[model samples]
Target: MLRRISFYVVIILFFLGGCSDEHGTSPTSFEYEALPAPGNFEITSGSYSLTLSWDYSPENIALAKEFFVYVVDPYQYGGNIYPVDTLTVAEYNTSKGCTFDKLAANMEFCFVVSAVDLSGIEGRRAEAECGTTSAP
Candidate 1:
């Protein structure tokens, strides 16, 4: 029984050792370098809607694969934010913005946009922009 238990332990140790890379780090471990945040974030208000826009430099544009848009209700959530939409580079270039419609009129919403690379890693978020929807 002692020998059997020792053999099982050795097998488990071997399997665990195999799970690491040559660098002695686990295979699941990764090093990430975050991209720069989007710039010139602006918001435009419309009746029951709001549009969020941002800018990126030529180098950043080349690095970014998509943009993640987040929204928050300052009054309700006390500044808690969540992602609402994602825009591909092509889609954003075409419209120059993303619109969220069917919102409560005359209500304020805050937004932040972040650039994501092809590997689906998101970078820092831009400064928040807030706007109130036009009265219906």
Candidate 2:
């Protein structure tokens, strides 16, 4: 009986020793700083498309790896926003804007642009710009 009790006590001590309140260090414990949002966001309507343009400071351009464009069809989904496209910093700098094509004619849409850093952290969205495509 004494030997069995000793074995049980050893098992209990082993289990208790494995449990601890302190948590191990996490692999992704570093904080991420978000990039700044793009400025001067504007949209121009086309036959069945919309062109979006925005400005970012040279300092911000150096930090951002890409830009994310989001769109909202307020008439159809009651202002439900969704990501539409992503443009590399080089692409944006070359064209100075992004074009969203193949849209419904004469329909109104809203757009916003955000900057994304190398770490894939997205910044706040710019002020929304709304426009209507030309009738086909």
Candidate 3:
């Protein structure tokens, strides 16, 4: 009878242990860090605007909560980068492009996209992509 009780106690303890967070790590034990940069950045021209496209970082898509799009207008400060938009994976169109409209026609613009994680961390941005909006 004692041996049976011991076996049941061991089984109960084992089940409780497995119920805890992964591998004995507490739920709050994990640390959040900035995600990696995006990849395959591309830009296209539109009438009085530009379109931006990029691939999620090789391993970052799973961790990324959203994406930030930045624009640098040469006409703004001879070139000054500014936050222009935010996008989610679901918003991508058939062409995989996010179009920024109402831009100054015939001007050059630069774009970069960064992944933002759940912890509100902004990751490194993809390489800058430059293009000129079609003349209006």
Candidate 4:
């Protein structure tokens, strides 16, 4: 009976060792580098809107598959980052500016632009820029 129990324990140990992963991580896990944040951010106030501009270049992008604009409503307490617009690679390649319209006059807004890769991962956010809309 003692010999039989030892043999069973050995068999269990062998199966467990075979099931162990060499990397000790999921096989689907992948590592990707994030893109650099946008630079030279500038803002202009307009009637009920704010215009945002930044320096952009094709060389500035690294592994970025797309771009997006994020906005923050300062008046709303605990304001979360919200996506206001989606930018395509082509649009981002050509235009350096975007506008946030239909906003409350005299209110200030903060903006950030981020790049997303093909894997649906967002990169680092640009420095936040705040601007106030024209008063009525």
Candidate 5:
């Protein structure tokens, strides 16, 4: 009886330990390098307003997850980090790449992307990031 119980316990432990999550995490993003810059990046359609788009390269982009673009207004004095209000697309587009549906016409904004990792240890920031949201 005792032997049977121990065997079952060991098997359960092994199964639990071997389980792998869909999203794998890298211990430290220090080694993770940026993708060779975003492709098909550009300023998309607007009411002559500010719009930005890119491939949003992430160092460790695991399956079943993706990045969210952000914008930073360095001139506005909000530090040097911000999430882009507009632009949402998983795969990169060849022509427009990504698009900001609507925005304040003639406004200024800078944009970037951060990976929403499942592990939640660190936010995946892109190195090929760029922005030019200057007031028009």
Candidate 6:
């Protein structure tokens, strides 16, 4: 019986040791990780508005509601950060898409999206870039 108890204790310790915050550090706090690889993203078009997309990441997400998308320019836009938009959809389409109706015509906008994991952790953003597509 003593031997069995020792074995059980060691097993429990191992299990606990493998768990920690997403940063691979001590679990003092918990936060979501950025979208996989190409974190938040953006796309634009002269004819229409900009579109953005991202990936879900952090290995483990618990309760994310939405992602914030930002569009802007270096000189013309306010603070290089324009209209901030929230992406709200079923878990199936939140971090993997963008919007066009959210922009204006003839405007040069940069795109970037960040993954707000289910756990409310704001992950890193994908690199930003500028572009414009033909409007409808």
lDDT of 4 by residue, 47-121 (tens): 998988876556645466788898876667656788988887777667767877888999878988887877778
Q: Can you write out model 5's per-residue Cα lDDT over 43-65, one digit (the tens) per residue?
A: 64455444555554344444214
- Stretches of candidate 2 exceeding 4 Å from the true structure: 1-32, 73-78
Q: Could you tell me which 10 consecutive residues in candidate 1 have the lowest summed lDDT?
A: 21-30
Q: Candidate 2 at 106: error in angstroms?
A: 0.6
What TM-score does candidate 2 get on C-alpha atoms? 0.72
Per-model clash counts, in order, read 0, 0, 0, 0, 4, 13
- Reference-based lDDT, each prediction: 0.88, 0.88, 0.78, 0.80, 0.51, 0.59
How high is the lDDT of residue 117 in model 5? 48
How would you encode candidate 2's per-residue C-alpha lDDT over 1-136 as one tens digit per residue? 9999999999999999989768877778677678877888889899999999999998889999999888876766457679989999999989889988898999888987899988888988887889899976
lDDT, candidate 4, equals 0.80
Clashes of 6: 13
Cα lDDT of model 6 by residue, 5-76, tens digit: 999999999999888556765657655434453443446354565555555643423345566677656676
Q: Name the runs in model 3 displaced over 4 angstroms.
A: 1-33, 57-59, 73-80, 93-95
Give me candidate 3's TM-score against the actual structure.
0.63
Worst 10-residue lDDT window, candidate 4? 55-64
Question: What local lDDT does model 3 show for residue 73?
Answer: 65
lDDT of 1: 0.88
Regions of model 6 farther than 4 Å from truth? 1-46, 57-64, 76-83, 89-95, 133-136
The alpha-carbon lDDT assigned to residue 19 of candidate 2 equals: 93
Residue 120 error, candidate 1, Å: 1.5
Instruction: Give me the displacement of residue 32 in model 2, in angstroms.
Output: 5.0
C-alpha RMSD in Å of predicted model 6 compared with the true structure: 14.5
